[model samples]
Target: MRISRRLRPRSLRTRLVLIATVLATSAVLVCQAAGLTVMRSWLTDQIDERLTDFRPPSPVYRDVADGNGLDHRARTDDVLPSDYRVFFYGANGRLLSESLGRSDGEPRLPHTAAALKLWNGRPTTVPAETGDGSWRVVADSGSDGMRAVVALPLDTVEGATSKLLWFSLAIGTVVAAAVMVLGSVAVRLGLRPLNRVEDTARRITHGELALSVTETSPDTEVGRLGIAFNTMLDQLRAALHRKDAFERRLRRFMADAGHELRTPLTSIQGFSELLLQQPAMAPLQRNEAHELIARNADRMSRLVDDLLMLAQIGDTPAIRRELVDLLSLAADGVTATALRHPDRDIRLVPLADEDTTPGELDVVEALGDPHQLAQVIGNLLANACTHTPSDTRIEVRVGTVRTGPRAGGTDRAGRTSAAGPMTPGIPASVIEVADDGPGLAADDAHQVFERFYRACHTGAVEAQPGSGLGLAIASTIAEAHGGRLELDTGTGEGCTFRLLVPETTAPKGHTR
Candidate 1:
């Protein structure tokens, strides 16, 4: 086993060639063996027929038989060639006459009683041995009770078989070698694509992801493999890019969080030191310092809480899903905002008749964590109230979207329309918070939902009290419930924050 393993070909091409050669050679050898067997059998059959015909003295043999002495007839060399020998044996197993007399004066047929009885006037072929070689002999007896035997040498058949064997071996060897060489070449060509794949892999391992295998056909094995490999590479590259982006976001978040926290911490520390050092300070000064410390501490605490919430949302948030009435939720958000800013005009427009009544709104439900969804609405309202002037008009529109945006529909001048029929899927609930205030610039509109991103302002209302995470958290919460938060804003026009959440038919107690 060890020796066979050692002799086995290592390369696929070599192994394929070896296998082809072995199978071809085996087939050739089997055919040659069968052919040789058939040829030898045919030749022996011809020799047997000749021997049987000679038993009843042919014309040549009869002519020789007319001679007076048996010796004279046997010695008629013209009648029989050297390859043919004839002999006569008496009933007592003694040699009577001989043609082509023995070299050492010994009888060609072995003297045995069984042999003499077997040859009693019956024609049969048998094998006999002489000093020279083996022979096939047919023996019979004439009316005079003398056994006549005709023999033919086996050398002719053996010589022909030997030549055929050598010729087959030579031809088979040449064919097998040719097959090996040609098979190796074919195998190499077939596996060339795999070699290219290996090279591509090596390049990818070295960080060269742009290289790809050229796929010529999708039906062939190598082509399919190339296509699959390229797809895998594409996925790998995309995953790596996502990883890099996530890391960058993480780093920037840490830096921004640290900076935001440091300000309140500095204020708290300074005010506390001031209060401690001035024991005889006035009551008003002491009260002012205490208030400042408490306010800054509260600010820091809110920042920390928001940071923790963001982290928790980054992981899979434990969302308790249940049926939620989006209109009722929007009404609650608007009520809360009105109480906080009573001077602002906040309008609640019911885009659908179902949103006009509380009972109807209850029927139009969405599946989500109600608390998170409410927080998203509350955050949008708070962002609008904080960014706009005290008298700016804020509108909260609630409706059910039976279909999504049409293929070529436009949203111009704050108006939207559908060009196609409603899609056959779950309906979505949309809530838009639009405010006529100092709207976001084009650049700020895109980065509004990014963590720690803030817009630039240049007036007295520029100082916005925010950690820049409210919109980001709202967007995250919206996505967690399989929804999205979108924004539309233009300079001096207004800003509209649209939140679309897919409505569900789950029972009131459904949880996920």
Candidate 2:
């Protein structure tokens, strides 16, 4: 008990050691105590039997002996050897005769209850002790009023008992010691995984979320605890990781905003300084300064507008029970994309004009802000143009889709329109804008969509032209419109960008 309390401050090793010691000690104590009980019973039995046989002959023996002179040596001659003793007396309790031979010099009689009972009763035995240590004595009385008593020296009896006790103590001590050692080792082995969990928990505060238990022995309480603890750690690590990523993204957004504004502010300051320093400069120089100032100011205005749109994307709710023309939206995207990148070639790919082109275009429209949809289209077109070489061709494809086999399954991607995010049988449309530029690398295709990431290896990315906010803004807009943006690596050729939007079946207030 004390050992357990003291172990609290030590390592796992100490606590395990304490547990092992207790179990081993208890096991050995029980075994030893049981052994002692059995031995005591066996020793007592032997002593009782020895005393019974050594008792002197009663009247029946004297009758059988007739004239042979009934003394202890002669009475026991046919039954016991000379190392035993016998004493005889009358029923009146008067001393008769006593005989002893080869008795190891210990007292023949201890004057115990066996002697007194022999003088009174017919037969009995009792424990006796003497100067030599201890003994077992017996007494017998007969109808003829003759009594017999027997006595055995206690030196040998005590010697055997002493040896037995020592043997038991020695064996129990050895076994208990061995168990303590072996049990300590086993306990430590079983608990090593728990120690690892402790260390992992401590490491968590240091920002290492990767620590986790690998494997452990099962079927025990400790093992279950380890499993549960590991599962909790996993959840905590995931939440912490998201929190860290969110904080990092927020800081990066602030820094990018400041940097973008600095360029326009610096230009405005320079133009104002020029005006102040030389108010009468030449017309050419004056015109150049005014152009520079206006361009920088316009850039700043565009930046602020995009930032505010991003802010409102999620908060502004769209009524889903409304309809708009999907194809018209595609046309508007082409014109807007052209205006953004006037130096690039942006074209709309016309599909086979079935009756569905017009009818489906109406149904393919989704319940969302058409202005926001146009913003998404504009962002995608701008992103593609930024990563495409001058004069590179861009194709914008738009059409309606069906879920069932009648309209042919979902698409080549193995995902049917039935499983599409816009709800099955709801006649949605997809805007596929692909560019034939040096396509993005296979590894970077997915990561390039991350906020502020530029495809450095694509060789066509605008490394410094604009804020890296176009793709993120486009993605946000797509999500707000109940749609998703999917990208293809286009390693074999140019990049493929697809926007899938759900169709609404209700009415629409006029939208552009």
TM-score of 1: 0.81
Best-fitting candidate, measured by lDDT?
1
Which residue window of length 10 is worst by lDDT in model 1? 414-423
Model 2 scores worst on lDDT over the 10 consecutive residues at 410-419
- The root-mean-square deviation over C-alpha atoms between each candidate and the true structure, in angstroms, is 5.6, 8.7
TM-score of 2: 0.57
> How far is 36's C-alpha from truth in model 2 (Å)?
5.5
Model 1 residue 388 CA deviation (Å) reads 1.8
State each model's CA lDDT, in order. 0.71, 0.63
Query: Which digits, one per residue and each the tens of the lDDT, describe model 1 over residues 368-416?
Result: 8888889989999998887877778998877665443421112334322
